[model samples]
Structure formats: C-alpha cells, structure tokens
Target: MQQIDAKQAMAFVRQRRDTTDPTYLFSDLDRERRQQAFIASVSHQLKDAGTFTDIGKMQGVLDAVSKNIVVDSDLNLIQLAQQATSLTGGNISFSTLPITGFGTSPDGASINTVDVKQVQATVKELLTPVPLAPVPTTTAIPTAATTSPAAPASEAAPASGAAAPAPATPSAPASNVYADSTGALQGGAIACVK
Candidate 1:
C-alpha cells in the first residue's frame, strides 16, 4: 500500500518515458497539465472500477487497491482497464509478465503449481477488451432544485382610496333583571325579584 503524490508520480512517469523520441516533446507546462489530467483520469477510472468489485468476494483485496492501484491480479487489472475505458475516453490493455510462482489458496496458503506459461496466457487474455463509448443516459440527472422566491416589490401608498366603514348596529339591550317598585320579577320564567 502506497500513497503517491501527484508531483512525485508525474516525475516518475516523465522519467519512464523514452527521451529519444523527438516527437514526444513535453514542456514544463505540458508536464503539469499531464499530471493533473492523469490524476483526474485515474480518479475517474477508480470510481468505475468500484462497481466491478462490488459483485465478488475478493472485495477486501479490491478495497485495498481501490485508492492505490500498484499491484493487482490479472482479472482485476482487466477490470480496471475496462473501467478506465468507460470512465475516461482512453483505451487500455492488461498484461502480466512471464514468471514462475507458487499458487495460493483463498486463505493465503501456498499451493503447489508449476505452470508459468498458463499464467502469462491468462494475463494476456485479460487484455482483450476494446474501449467502450459511454452511452447517453439520464441516470445521473440532478433532482429538481427549487429556487428562493424573490422579494415583493415596493408600492406607493394609495391616495383617496379608503372608504368610511359602516356604523355597527347596537345590539338590543337584554331585558332589565331588576323588579319594579312592587319588588317582583316581571318574567315568570325566572322567579327572583329585584
């Protein structure tokens, strides 16, 4: 596991390029742009590559290399290349060098195996995918965003527009509860006298 900074990795890439090719001229400005482009491209490539790893049990190993892809199996490398093609407009191929090695079990135990050519061929087979053009789709369309309403416009006060309000009608006063000089209630429903 290694964290490679953009500048350091670009310098390494520049060193690896063939200096003898005069046609491959790159200035300092170009180098900077290339570095930024490469970082962006690889970031996009990894994002696409994440989808492939979600479908398998080897996700732990995939996660380890998800952010930093330096060593990976042939199958993973092919998947990464395919993802790169889908995410970035670049064709990529996968291949492994010829080397003899012991096989390992899923639990990381070494197993006895002696076929180097088969491994190399398998790696070569992983590189056969061609670049794929991104299909036009609406899956990533953003949700409907609501904007804030504008403030109300200022208005001049109206002149001579107010009308006089109608006078409220007086409610009929309730009948007087007090009795007359005789000291008896006038209504028969209530028996109290004033």
Candidate 2:
C-alpha cells in the first residue's frame, strides 16, 4: 500500500551513494514517458516481483493506465492498468506524450516542453471509459425506388424522333464492407459496419 515516486528514488540514491547521479540518470524522460515507466515497473512487480512470466503481461501493459493506482482489488486497476486487452488494438500505455513543438532552452540544453495541465488532461481522457453509442434503429422496410425507374416522367410529351431517354441504370448501393466469400447477397447491396 505504499506509493513510490521518482523523487523518492532520487532521494534514496542520493542518501545511499551520497550523490545526485540518480536524478540526472532519467531526468531527460518527459512526464508521460516517466509515468509509463512507473506503470510498467509496477505492473511487472505485481506479476512476479519484477518479471513478466504471466500470459497477460503484454496485453496488460498495452492497455490504458493512470498515475493513480488502486490496489484494494486486483481487477479494479484500470487507473494503473487497463484490462480490456481485447479492444486495445495492441496499444500500450507507456508511450510518451506528444510534444507541442521543438525548441531550445535558455541554457542551450535541448528540451521538450509540455503544458502540465494539457498533458494530464489528455492522460485522463485516455483513462476514462467511453460508453458505446447506441446503434441507430431502423426498420428493414423494403422500397421500390431503387428497383423501379421514375415511371418515365408520367404523362410528359416526347419530342419528335428523340430516342426515349434510355432508362437510367440503377446505381450501385453503398457497401461499407467487402467480404471474400459471398453468401445470400445480390450483386449490389448496402452493407453496414457490423
């Protein structure tokens, strides 16, 4: 139930070794990267005291995570490790936050500056669970507009010898998906994402 911070590690290193070398070792890493490292370290520690011998190790790390980790229950750990591995699309949480732009510091030590609030806000957005939108409900009512032509402008007079305007060919229905094998489908039809 104890929290470990980079500052604490730095302090310990400083105390034991009597030097500040630890702080300088990984200070170049940005906030997101550092946070990611922390999450990964913690996740590994939980699995086998700093080893990844579990089957869900990769999937666990790829899921979203927050700086604040809750450990009262193993499953209630999305804040520290997202568990919806099936939907993660093979993404990981330890990635670095995008940089606003590239520039040099006053002291000439190359640096990547990020807005503190913006970065945290973005991280929160990633951690929050999004409700799946309700699929639009529509009756599968059949209509003939696509099958039948416009009744040839009912009652309109035709010009002398002008070949009756060729009946317009029915256009292809929109297909959002394509299948390798066909099943009970006509040449053209509207397909949803499903």
Candidate 3:
C-alpha cells in the first residue's frame, strides 16, 4: 500500500467510480466503507507516527482539519484528543447498516432497499449491552456435625404450591450484521477501497 496525503485521501473516500468492479465502490454504502477506512487509517497513522505526542505535528493536523471538520460548540478539542489517546487502532471497527436489495427509485435513480424492522432490530441489538457472565460461586459443603437434619420434600415445598423462580439466563450474543455483507471494515491498517 502507498501512503496518501490529505488531498488523495479525500479523493479516495469521495470517488464513486468503477461500478462494474466487484472490489471497487459503486454504492453509497461502499463510499461509507471507504470513508470509515480512511478515518481508521488516519487514526492509526496519527498514533503510529507519534503525531499525538508531537505538538507541532498535532497543531499542523488540527490547523488543516479544523477548516473542514465541524464539532459541537462546547466540544473541547484538547480534551477530546486527550480522551482519544487511549483508543488504539484495534478499538475501531465499522459496519454499514444491512440493506436488503437494490431497487430503482421513482426518479429512476438506483437505491439500496432495506427492511425497516430488521434495521430497527439490528440497531436495538447493537445498542443493548451484553450481560456479563455470572461469576462462579463456591458453596461450601456442610460437615455432618454442621448439617441440619433432612426435611421431608413435602415440608420443603412452598405452602402455596408455587415453584421457586428459575435463575435468569444470559442473552445470546448479538448476531454479526456484516456476516453476509461486504460493508464491514476494520481498523489498524490501510484498507483497500474504491
């Protein structure tokens, strides 16, 4: 892979050429993947090249990007950068929302068709925090001297005839939305994109 400057990076991310090539970007989703790849590359490069540690390089990058990037009014760039310092290249991953199929719009423009319910479900799954596995507990066995006399099964049963509630089960892991899709992009390297 070749190193690219900001201008080349912008062009690479924005280009919509080569629709016929299976490996190249043609759809809006492909462009988004390219954009995500670019961001990952830049983030990795910034950390790899020690740009964050170098005030001059950091200022240069800020000066260049501040012109093109927008942020909330109260966002502190320094604080954000500080926070970002803890994020490694491995921390970044990107995936586009799943699309059903391609369709022609009323205006004859091509569009990706998506299932709204599936999208909602996928989003909900992505947002829901996974429950942590229960820590293994050790129950000490009582010695014969310490153990109480065994009670009859009927006596141990609740008077109301209700059974004890079962322990809650952990939710299954989220399904990978990108498993059958090509829109997944990972960080830590310069990903080839259209």
**What C-alpha lDDT do the candidate models reach, one value each?**
0.46, 0.45, 0.66
RMSD of each: 37.8, 18.3, 11.2
lDDT of 3 by residue, 78-143 (tens): 654554555555766575789999899999998899999999888777655677667656688779
Off by over 4 Å in 3: 19-25, 53-63, 135-194
> On residues 74-135, what C-alpha lDDT tens digit does candidate 2 reach at each position?
33333223232321323333445555765699999667788888887876665455544445
The TM-score-based order of candidates, best leading, equals 3, 2, 1
Task: Put down candidate 1 lDDT per residue, 1-194, tens digits, no spaces.
Answer: 35578687757556533478978744443444555566565655555666434545235545575456433233444444344334344432222344354467899975545477886576555433443444445656564542455344344333488764344554432232332334533322222111
Best by lDDT: 3
* Lowest-sum lDDT 10-residue window in model 2: 185-194
lDDT of 1 at 174: 28
TM-scores for candidates 1 onward, in order? 0.20, 0.26, 0.59
Listed per model in order, the count of residue pairs whose N, CA or C atoms clash below 3 Å is 0, 0, 0
The regions of model 1 sitting more than 4 angstroms off are: 1-12, 15-29, 49-194
All candidates in order of lDDT, best leading: 3, 1, 2
> What's the TM for model 2?
0.26
Q: List pairs with backbone clashes in candidate 1.
A: none
